[model samples]
Target: MANNTTASAASASTALKARIYKAPEKAEISGRSIFLAGSIEMGAAEDWQTVMTNRIAHLPITILNPRRPDWNNSWKQSASDPQFREQVEWELDQQERCDVIAMYFDPNTKAPISLLELGLFAQTGRMVVCCPDGFYRKGNVELVCERAKVPLVQNLDQLIDKVIEKLTEEKA
Candidate 1:
């Protein structure tokens, strides 16, 4: 029993230290990075990105999460704004360079940016999408996934599992 408890504790500690690429100022490392693109709208208290990071922390990779915990939607949408430009540019570059892009559309929000990202990388053959039935444009996302052959999941758990599968396949 003590052995098992010690093993679990070690695992949890390692997971807690998992690298999360949230700011562009961080050093760019060479390794598989999973760019997490998803819904972030008003009143969204669920931090799916953190859940995902913990789930896959054992893997030797970085998780690029674009959702800021303190995001302000009212910020100007132009690139001229320093903060806006940094966030946008970092996400775009991370998406392009990442080994896999995992996108999820929370049923409660429209997730317009996620939709655009799905369109942008649907054909990359390196994307895992989760657009639950309740999303406003589930049909469109489904069609795109079908035509592009992107693996789609039904929920957050499935998304994490699929991502793990992809990472394992890449390693093998």
Candidate 2:
């Protein structure tokens, strides 16, 4: 009976520790919510997303990724589809609920949809940050970012630092 009690207590203690040390479901991004808008087809976007996720994990803000599965599945279909419009609207709604927008624009391909999303975010007067491919410039994306007043960042390190600075300034 004593051994059984000891085993139960050990299991309970282990479970408690597991719960205590569990990582949060969503990373902190300061008090502000940021929408991650990027070209989902490019490999660089995935790398940037991973870096951004790690950087955001330590902040207090919420990061919203519309490219995520739960946001919509219309991206899998043709952009001309009527359902795509609905999805775009829904994503715009999500963007409205956010405080800022961060986008990854690789110069190799013109990400038309990302530019559209940037336009919407800009129309709302939200802050926009663009991470462009380091190798190339002078793309149409530069024009959009310029018009939107989005700061272009060269790398993930720069982006992380800038985001932190922006969040701190906003709090001040």
Candidate 3:
């Protein structure tokens, strides 16, 4: 029993020393960013944001436009001042800094800004993932995705899983 205890203690000490001396591994998703392109006016945006946020919370990546203040009250101020422009620049910077982008398309109404972002990402040859709702798939979403060369996913759970998988593959 005494010999066994001494061996365990030695093993623990070795592990502690290794941990102290070893350099930390780089994060799997470090420096990665994602732009969430979706309809801000529709209720779908809030629902999708909640789902995406819960799914990607563990990742070492950032998601842009996950939440915004009440548009009805803030739109006037956002348009009049430079605040909206600053936010756009910030999102664009994050996009440039990221390795992959995940976008959501809701078919009830077209989000012109989202489509523009998709085009930009495509032009830059960045990895783009599209999450389109059932309604969106029946609309012009396919054309947009085709133009952007982005793979369309059906739901948020799948989107998160795919992102994690891609990050793992990139690391490997």
Candidate 4:
């Protein structure tokens, strides 16, 4: 009886919680997950990750957000840079593992990395992109999305709507 009680208590203590894991920080990922992959061009982009996380906090899922609060712009982009390499690797791993990838492109910023990610994952059928008007690469994004048959929207609100739809659709 004591052994049973102890095991139950331990399991409850370590039970998974709905949370957000920012860049370079990961965990033994469990349950439904969505990777927040989008425009984060050295703060040129808006803080969409926070908004997304807050909007979806009630869901039973983990949000893998790649916006690093302590990101140092001095770091080299090459794999030789430890921090940069780790952040890239973590984002890639989470994107691959996550059930869905929710991406956004802001018009005010030219997000090269976000463009690359969109290209890389467009055919995966796990991505939903929101590239609003005035974005530098809106045409390219739209054409690719059309060719790949990926879901594309015009704004953040639509992105949230689609994300919830996808997540709930999967659960059903």
Candidate 5:
């Protein structure tokens, strides 16, 4: 027989209103949480995090978004830069704390950091990656995901589905 517990968990998740926490502020993840780990090179990438937020807003979860609204493009990206260091540390900390890392590789942007994140978290089995066709390192992403047994999707829609799947599975 199918598990009644799984059905009840999925039903409960649907009633959840999502709470989002942007960077620099430490989030209190009381329950399920996901870190939006993706391409955020200001101009190079689109605000895909918003899309993820809108889609998953119904799920009872905390979204750890690193796209700071007050981001200053002129800040020096160096170890000596306090703001830069704070942002980096916040992202790292949130990713480590979250249950899931929803990562994306935008095709138009060369997301070197996203690739680095894939290497960092692929083996953790807490990642659901979306590397669409034309993304510069799709092949590399596929190989790592395949080996790590991570769920990899072809596009944003599928990525959302996979993330929801992971969240529901986590509930069980």
Candidate 6:
């Protein structure tokens, strides 16, 4: 009976909504949530957010990915654009509410926004950062994470593993 209940729980968690983005109204308020904060300037063809989500598909946590495929980084338009406003607001809310925030910095992009977000939550103890040595501002990121006592991984795999370990510990 215990084994059956465990299997059923795992099956149900797998079936629960795994990917969430720009759907604040449709979000599942239950269960633990991990806000995927990472490099988005890799290009239109490259989406690290989705890649991370796929890696952790087995986990039963909600993924808050703000990477909109159609996003256009028009700074001037964002101020008055309703869509952009909604997206940014949603991200902020999710960031605050998420149990864990996994951040990755791809060496290929400058990722200034990711850096700013990292600064915002580095000390919250809810962050797991991956900033490889090749990143332009890796030293700064490393220093911040070190000071904040946030776990810093050298690669995406470690980042994912850290998130999984942390969330699993919570369940225990």
How are the candidates ranked when ordered by TM-score, highest leading? 5, 4, 1, 6, 3, 2
lDDT of 5 by residue, 90-148 (tens): 98898888999999989998888788888998888799999889998789999999999
Each model's lDDT: 0.76, 0.54, 0.51, 0.81, 0.83, 0.73
**TM-scores for all predictions:** 0.85, 0.62, 0.63, 0.87, 0.87, 0.81
In model 6, what lDDT does residue 92 have? 79
Record all residue pairs in model 1 with backbone atoms less than 3 Å apart, i.e. clashing.
none
Q: Give the TM-score comparing model 2 with the true structure, all chains together.
A: 0.62
Candidate numbers sorted by lDDT from highest down: 5, 4, 1, 6, 2, 3
Q: Using lDDT as the measure, which candidate wins? A: 5
Candidate 1, residues 71-168, lDDT tens digits: the string is 57777899888888888888888888888899988998888888888989888888999988888899999999999999989999999999988876
Question: What TM-score does structure 5 among the candidates reach?
Answer: 0.87
Candidate 6, 29: how far from true, in Å? 2.8
| Residue 155 CA displacement from its true place in model 4, Å | 0.7
Clashing pairs in 6: none
Q: Which of candidates 2 and 5 reaches a greater lDDT?
A: 5
Q: Point out where model 3 deviates above 4 Å.
A: 1-30, 42-44, 70-80, 131-139
Error of 3 at 104 (Å): 0.5
**Worst 10-residue stretch by lDDT in candidate 6?**
1-10
lDDT agreement of model 4 with the native? 0.81
Global CA lDDT of candidate 2, please? Answer: 0.54
Kindly report which residue stretches of model 2 are placed more than 4 angstroms away from their true locations once superposed: 1-30, 42-45, 69-87, 123-125, 131-138
Best by TM-score: 5
Q: After superposition on all CA atoms, how large is the RMSD of candidate 5?
A: 7.3
